[model samples]
Target: MSTPAALRALLDGRWSDLRERTRRQLGVVELPPHGLDRERHREHVLRQLRVLASAGHPSTGFPVRFGGGGDLGGSVVSFEMLGFGDLSLMVKSGVQWGLFGGAVQALGTERHHERYLREIIELDLLGCFAMTESGHGSDVQHLRTTATYDAAAGEFVVHTPEPSARKDYIGNAARDGQVAVVFAQLVTDGGEHGVHALVVPIREPDGSPCAGVSIEDCGEKAGLNGVDNGRLSFDNVRVPREALLDRYGHVAEDGTYSSPVDGANKRFFTMLGTLVRGRISVAGGALSAAKKALTIAVRHGETRRQFTRPGGGEEVPILDYLVHQRRLLPALATTYALHFAQEELVSTLHEVLGGESDVDDRRQRELESRAAGLKAVATWHTTRTIQECREACGGAGYLAENQLPQLKADTDVFTTFEGDNTVLLQLVAKGLLTGYRDHVGDLDALGMARFVATQFVGVVIERTAARPLIERLVGAVSGDDLHDRGWQLKLFEDREEHVLDGLVRRLRAAGDGDAFEVFNDAQDHVLRAARVHVERIVLEAFVAAIDRCPDTEAAELLERVCDLHVLSAIEADAAWFLGHGRLTPARAKSVTGAVNRLCKLLRPHAATLVEAFAVPTEWITAPIAQR
Candidate 1:
């Protein structure tokens, strides 16, 4: 593929420098050899975590004020790149920094961070995020762990009341971890408060198990075996009441509980919602895996010939086939989409942390909404594209040596972790609804400006007639004619609004009866809606990137990528077009034709598209590459 001079120039500057530095740091660490055996896989993961610690990759994100080598964005950036190395290592690093350390930073009071953040960051004290339990996975509120206040002893007695109450599938729990940031129900005289975090010391400094803390290894599982997954139970384990890590809720000396956030249930959701960072991290890792796989598969297809050229005399690369291009190129496009979205997400997160915006109720809600939407779409797309990339590589994809099989296995867990895809999609659904409610009433006066606004345009699209005419006019064009650039642009723009309207209408008619249930009931429709919304955002981002492109050729290639991506995604959902009367039969057929033609057009540059991501080679040492 050709380089867009603009993108290459940007990649050469600070971004390139950062990528090199990260690659150097990550290169010093190496994961253990792969094994087809599951138990051996688990062992390999543990070994890699130790390697990661020794390389000092986990401490890069902590605040320098707390003895960390503060570079929050760079830390996450580096960690995301670790997907190029191994998914297990990336997740292990996440558990160390994003979860254990993040829990302390986001939920714990200053004292907790001062006491444990440095140690955890430095990997001197390994930890687990003990939240998911046997009875709870995505529905964290249902978890049964308890931390009953023992006023007489001035402590909290942590106990797992039943076998099901045991924390199951906790990474780093059975071994390595000396402490855990445990999530459990906080019970005080203030009544049964919803789940809150408590910092618990699970082992002595010498690594001996502490009294009342029981650990049981999960043994073996699907993917990510390098890190130990274990079950943990506490039998009246006592900790000083201050161990509650009360950043949001605190218990007073007189047994009273106080919190700045109102309503216990809301507070619980608010607290759990902070894990959006983890969700975004999962998106990053999943994308890295998908992108690496596509890069390998594309490069392999170009060099590996199985058939004669079309004219029949000489051998030709497998990628010369239109079918191969269609299969692999869209996956490459999605890789770009996910990467761009993540960069936007990371920037937003930094702004939130830097106090660029007030962390008030409104701002928090906005952050939460954006996080849910981006995470839901990005993770779901990553899994779908990873599977596609695997198939694109054919039989070789199944081989562990190529890393696709292992990459897929490790990444498959991401959709369910952080929050199950279904649950997170519903959260995004509610956010869409909430945003709709806020904006719909004001659509009348701000009608013109609605199109210009980045968000809240859906309500305007639905509440007006002008959008219908626009759709009708755009729908008149045939998808087959490659010469109609103006018409294609108009069609793309109209289709975007219609898609947003279709979703807004569906959500509005559902009328607020359990956001998750509404989304679940209309699961297929809601997901389609979210995809359209996300794709539109991504395409717009890609187009905007053209201006930022330093070279005319790279900019042109990126524009084609944006076109191919938008068309393919739109064509995939052409059913929405037919159902809504937005497109006639001929035009609907044209959508498919347009997508196919675009795929062929962009096939030559698939490699360059993935490379444009500028991911570190150290992080993405997949087996497939140009030799």
Candidate 2:
């Protein structure tokens, strides 16, 4: 029998020490109480924020020169752990370090970092990531906010040109923030360069709004009310030229503009790519929420008795029923699969951004593409799984203290935030069509589909992890054994290739004529391609993880769990396989049968599997889950 400890060692992966420390430290502040007024809730969260900062909890991602540990992967893993605590605190911390502070560290030069990074890390200066606007949410390249260089004054005038330009849904802006990393169009002399970030003050030393700045509370949201989300507008707000975060782009005091990146579009995107950590962080946190939700639901099912057997000698545990297992077990399997995928993603991020290698453009674009796809997949999984988990617990899961309702509400906006799930998927599809052909790589959203006419040769199913092992396993398959790991791997790969081929045909047929229109027409196909591609990546990561497990019994358990995840994914998309001729009618039916059997086979181990997630005891205060 595989012990939970053995399984936890596998799930913890590279950042085991950091994960353990975060759980212990964060457990000190239990989940916030329900029904506190928004003000009280915000105040409570702020106090906790101070406590965390005082202990250097927020410095993992920053440079060592700036009072930080300079551990980028640790920063991401730590944020993921926060998902099991008060989600409001999670979001607030993300804004403070991952976004606002991240922008400064990644985009700003030494002058910017030296002047402000220490205070930002220490919580002496709370700030906002002012990117999203009322008029433009996902369309970030054409923001209406402007930072015009005033050569005579040696300053830049940050202005919100219209109502639509006002920054909306900004955490830390409604209150507590002293500054904002505002994204705006930068104009020098007479020409507009493109959108750039400037560190502009929102609050004065005494905590009053700056003279030309307007701020309004977004007010009680459906969830995360403690985050202090608000709207902001600027009216010719002036900041010194040094305020610009000038890593990829720059402006001289004489009103001259230049950038290391050649094209205006490319330069803006290169600058944005430096901050991909925010998107990756969101994906990790979303999975953490999914894990917590699944843990709660699975624990309850193990002990909560349901309808009795036919003879009525005793009521069976809900987890023993095939139906309840179907509801939670397949989802539990997916949660495990996603956890492995996320771990691989973080490591890739660490290696690429950790300065171990040169900044190759192709690798950079690939990283961004993977980040976008995983973020979309993970967040959507979180939203869907939490709802299912809530339903699994019946009435008891709805109570305030059970944590499911709060988890459901807090994570609902994840699919839309960071970047809308739909848009992110489209970006991934665009990459599949035009990316990696002849070493050409680009990630600009508008130009993403432009090269599809010449770039796409054929589908290249590159394994993201353990390539030799995966190829060996995939090569050994002789028959369509649904339980065979090789067959499952090929199945996912074949489906993804077919989806991309069909999408390519549709787009290629519209050559030289209204390309955007045709791409839009095939939007459904595009999203499906992205989804399947991500599914393939996820399976490879899971297989690679299983190969690395040291404990024999735990690896065996994970193999079955991995089977549950892949079979369930295929079963859910049975129609596609049937229509695409990849699966016979018999095999399609067997997919469902296999999923049902796996769920039943995995039922007895539900508690052990979720226990491996090692969610802190304080966070699981659900009455039904009482130990």
Candidate 3:
């Protein structure tokens, strides 16, 4: 709810207004034209592409030199706001800006950037990120598409080569796209260079399929039907060898290939690391959608009368009921934490791109790890919150007119898209292992010796010891009457380390070629550890916000919100804490008690927090507006 002044200022600039006008234009000229029927929704998605092109969402992200506004931050901000009108429209806009234009800006060289970036940015050429294939949804390296170098003609021949190689579930593919940033294994006379992106023009200027490119529309989906998702297959599609976006690697004349990064595996991951940007944006997008649902649910609950109050003369607003408030308010607190985290993420992105700090190999991995962790946690949370928001609305929630079902359907794909949440969380766990490994080396002999002695001996020697002085410090500040933030944080940290150490030991024990097998087998436990780590991060963020609040009332409200977040997160993982001795029976009970108390305390601010998002009045006007 508390936005930095600079962020607020950016939100008020010309770009923001241009974005808002784009939304209004979309709402007026786009949605109505698309219609609601399944086929119509797909048509509408395709039609809205042209509409957005006219309104300039696609061109907003590119540099002015490339016929764009050249403001990435402003563009994403505007893209997020488009969700206020319609998510389908927002997604179509993303397929244009984030995928099509972004591919050129991030992966392509200056020549490629100049050649195609302008048309793509201008929406004169709609494009798709043709990366996900039928057989290799998450494992991009295993994708079957191939780009074989042809020395005679000096062009690379692209081919699906098989059914599994067909790029599946691509947006803007069925009806609108002329180009796609196709991900395929680039093979030359030298060797197979993992996956590389090639700009393939899949449609001609006359809106007809280009030579050797075939598309099949994926039929109606549960959500986002407004966006056409199609399967694409290419057969001996040829493009100049120069089409290879050679930022990381390149092919020389006479069929030679070279790269700055030596290791094949490292180069592969480095290329995919570009996708971390999308994952971070997805996390922010999830928060924006969750906040929207919470806004509607809270406002409706505040005004809609339910069972009788103590007086018994008339029914009460649903929000006054303890059950209703408890169900929705904690979700509101999470939305706040996610919002703050998103700001941090955007700042990191700008820092890396602006060269404020070196985004070297290690830093890139760290950024990817954090982005994945946040995306997994936030998307999973958003889906759950959407369900809770719908249930809180009771019958009206299911109605098509209210937009809850539509919102839920559209957002459902977020957990799996960008990257599968489970897969991503494991990446976070691997990052934690890497961090621990770094510490073990950094600590040297004496430090390592002390760590080993304390971990092993302290447990035995201090078995009967009472709570430490810090426990009292935690309880004093937390006021929860049982456990405290200090204990919860400590326990999460300890448990995370133990889990990672155990997994690593198992992995090492598995030995040779089965390393992947060992890693896959330990994935469940690793992901659980990652979840715990993310929860701790969110709790710390919540508490930090509360600690820094300058206003008395705001501070008190923030403290309650922090309590709500921590208690709810603990209750969600009660089994883990109980088994690991992090929480006693009484402390576990207090988690629920704290949840109830904080939920009640936060009920009044629920609507306020959502409104602070500043979504346009048209999308959500008041507590009672039906549309």
- Candidate 1 per-residue lDDT, tens place, 308-386, comes to 8557987878887888888888767766656665666666565555333335554455556556666777777777877
- What value of lDDT does candidate 1 attain over all alpha carbons? 0.69
Q: Tens-digit lDDT track for model 3 on 1-627?
A: 453332333333334465456556555443433237867776766676677677666665578887677656656666667766667777777877787677777777789887887777666677898999999998887899999999889999999988988999998898778789899999998889889999888988888889999989898888887787889999999999888888888988788988976777777877777656677777877777887788789878877986785668788889988899878988887777776555555555555553423356666666677778889999999999999999999888877667677789889999999889998887676566545332222432233333433443211111001234334534555534433657555655566566656655555555553434655676677787687677656655555444545556566655566667767877888887798777788878878887887777777777666666666666653334443
Number of the top-ranking candidate, with TM-score as the measure: 2
Give each model's whole-structure lDDT: 0.69, 0.87, 0.71
| Pairs in clash, predicted candidate 2 | none
For each candidate in turn, give its C-alpha RMSD to the true structure in angstroms. Answer: 5.9, 1.9, 6.3
lDDT, candidate 2, 354-376, per-residue tens: 67345767777778888999999
| Candidate 2: stretches off by over 4 Å | 356-358, 436-450, 460-462
TM-score of each: 0.86, 0.97, 0.86
| Model 2 worst lDDT run, 10 consecutive residues | 437-446
TM-score of 1: 0.86
TM for candidate 3 is 0.86
lDDT of 2 at 577: 82
